[model samples]
Target: MDVDPLLTQARQLWIELAGAPVAFPTRGVAVVASAESSTCPPGWVGIVALGDAAICTVPTDDLVGVVTRACHMLPVAALTDPERLAAVLPVTQVLGPATLAYCDDHSYRPQRRQPIEQLPVHHPDLVDFLASVPAEDAAECGLTDITSAAYVLRAGTAIVAAAGYRHWPRRVAHLSVLTAPSRRGRGLARAVAGAATADSLADGLVPQWRARPAASRRVARALGFRELGAQLSVRVGGSDQTRLGPGSNTTAP
Candidate 1:
């Protein structure tokens, strides 16, 4: 499979952050390595692979031990190195795998030529409007100066959809989006996402759309985003925490 240049660059950044040698895995495998301090969540090591990467901040490097009991659940080929494979596995048994999607200027298409409102992060109305959404969504959309830009779609006085990006390493934009539940299925998510992605491209930032839903993937595909690959996430506890799909919290290119 042809790797997107942007994806390659993202992988390089992750490898550098991991402070480990690059080990791009084959089509259906994952690789794990020690991560630099604070590069990943506390207590876990960062794992990166072309197919299913993960950051396990679990404070221990004994992944081999964890996978030993579940050896039968994984593919034999994927167990070439139990320790490395464990790093990419779900931190817990309950949480399913996650995915990371991304797009560059070459892949993104700003097709939704609808009117989008660029709202000030500190605007009173925007602040009040964001309060109605999830805290993570508001923070991801630039609750402060950390965001590069944010855009929204309004119907009358109500904000129906919003999109934005936070600055990530290597000039990448971690894009996020949200659409009101009552206003979903109307393509509002795609419109706002396109607006924000276009702004990211204009500012020379690669938009990284990390999501886990088929619907969100469709919105991304509508805007010409491609699936870089899937990722895995397992919380320390049994809580099944995964990044929301497009239109809910995080969005695509």
Candidate 2:
């Protein structure tokens, strides 16, 4: 697919995921208070900005004016910048500042590493595979909770690598991939993820890769995914505040 159209489609998928209908401003940022946003934790704020434009989602209508004012005061880039966003929004808690990347059929680069298996997301061997990885990695990848068919690689009977997607509205396949610590340096991540990405594309769903780790992002890029936007989830309410850094959670939906 042409990069422009692919990117536009990707942007539309995020707009639909924002829950309440809203569009990015031509300049600065657009803030919308909508309780329907699934991308944010219940009662949290969500920001999805493609390139220079942005749309912010808050829980209540009362906060829209404040958030709009605060967000508009800064550059649209601040929504993806944790420190800048936290300074302005009433960020009581935060989830990620993940890079939102998208891949389509034309741009996809399939890997030759093979013998991959397509399994249902809830296969029993998957639990053992998840147990083998670090808790933080498991939390970040979220492979066990994916709703799409899994593309996995195995070592004997042990599943060493896995990739899949959660079926989001608007034909978005949010991708998740994880490799065992022992299996990290191998090309298994690329193989399984490439398989999953190909499968998602074949099913006519846009594959969305939200990655926090550089390695994970590298895998997506290697598969020809373009970084089109950034997603951040913030809980806004009382005076209690926390910032995103080493200690904060980076897990996102």
Candidate 3:
């Protein structure tokens, strides 16, 4: 109910330990006991309480362990201990999917690399872009509109990199940026991310970042988004009884 207090507290902890950029909280989400608040940035979507006592509003898994240390919390029980669902929260009722992870935003620092000229959507180019990344990974990343996705090129032929963003309510926008393994270390990721950030800022939508691996947090830090903390999204049966935090008894052991 009172997520702000936890969000505020997480912000302070994230900055101190994670060296993350700055991050904000989103609205309309339940707040865990440790999180300061549920209010997030226009692009960010949810607020997750970290074990180390931070709240992640952005998309950085790097800090999950950090939070665990601080909060004396365990790794997401859902993934590791699926049967332990009842221990954390009730599984019978409508407890949202307990997909928990730590997150944070890096302050947006301008990328110092040379810019890549924008290229229009060419079906071949889009296919090429998709081909560069692992097929399954790409799908998992939610690459549906290859034509609408943004890309960077080199030598006028090679589809070096690409990224995409999707909009959500509460001013939240999702980010999915990818670079070819061969073309990495060339700032292509940053270029695509810059495009997404510019668009979000222009539209006044808060970008909710969810980096799959821990390394991607660097990209967010360079962009000026701060770290919010981790979150747990549990989707159980459609019932009001399944809620997170200390007061909410819906959670199982």
RMSD of candidate 1 to the truth, in angstroms, is 5.8
Q: RMSDs, each prediction?
A: 5.8, 4.1, 12.1
Candidates sorted on TM-score, descending: 2, 1, 3
* lDDT ranking, best first: 2, 1, 3
C-alpha TM-score for every candidate: 0.72, 0.88, 0.51
**lDDT at residue 35 of model 3 (Cα atoms):** 29
CA lDDT of each candidate? 0.58, 0.77, 0.44
Please report how far candidate 1 places residue 178 from its true position, in Å. 0.5
User: Candidate 3 lDDT, tens digit per residue, 1-253?
Assistant: 4555324543443333222343333422212221222223222222344433323332234434433342233343232232453354333422232222222233345555555555444557766766767776555444443223454555467766666555533444556666766666766677776676665656765554555354466666566655544433333233232223211111010
Strongest candidate by TM-score? 2
**Model 3, backbone clash pairs (residues 3+ apart or across chains), number:** 67
User: Model 2: runs farther than 4 Å from truth?
Assistant: 1-3, 239-253
* Residue-wise C-alpha lDDT for candidate 2, range 79-179, written one tens digit per residue: 77878977876676667788888888889998896899988877888887777778877776777678888888999999998988888777888888888
* Candidate 2 C-alpha error for residue 49, in Å: 0.8
Name the top lDDT candidate. Answer: 2
Weakest 10 consecutive residues of candidate 1 by summed lDDT: 240-249
| Decoy 2 TM-score against native | 0.88
Is 1 or 2 the stronger prediction by TM-score?
2
For residue 159, model 2's alpha carbon misses the true position, in angstroms, by 1.2
lDDT (Cα, 0-100) at 93 in candidate 2 = 69
Question: What's the TM for model 3?
Answer: 0.51
- Using lDDT as the yardstick, the better of models 2 and 3 is 2
